[model samples]
Target: MNAERVERIRAALEDAFAPCAVQVADESHRHVGHAGARDGRGHFAVEIVSAAFAGMAPLARHRAVYAALGTLMQTDIHALAIRALTPEEAHAAASRG
Candidate 1:
């Protein structure tokens, strides 16, 4: 279930953004026994770099990603940590790291 959720998120973001880099981390373990995780729902952290996010506000980018996920939010996923960026922004963040 966890792997499937991750793959779904990866595919959705990959198709919508055409990201240069995309990573989806399962964070459900961190919230085990919590309200959402108790039912086997997925908690995820996603980092995506794509030109589709260029000039978009942070909230807008997040909204776009959430929109791409469609009904998954209600049925499978409970939490999402999004780091959406353009290629240049991703590069700059990488250099800082």
Candidate 2:
């Protein structure tokens, strides 16, 4: 696991969204010999709850995240799966449980 890259991603997201909840996971180990992994870049997943996504649609929220990461998207990520939610949405979802 590349701790530096994980930190880099976490820092970028925190800077961009000031998320109430955010988790970044490097799932590359599961990808092993998979095709995109061959490029040396890693696959990641991010779930973030932030007011930055307050009124945005899902695609827009993802685009915001991508923009925040800027050049890192090209330099580091092979694939990213994102789940972005507003604080209210997050709270409501939790309450449902």
Look at candidate 2 and tell me the lDDT of residue 96: 100
What lDDT does each candidate get? Answer: 0.91, 0.91
Candidate 2 lDDT over 1-62, as tens digits, reads: 46788889999999999999999999989899999999888999999999989879999999
Give lDDT for model 1: 0.91
Off by over 4 Å in 1: none
Candidate 2 to truth, TM:
0.94
**True-structure RMSD for candidate 2:** 1.0
lDDT of candidate 2? 0.91
TM-score for each predicted model, relative to the true structure: 0.94, 0.94
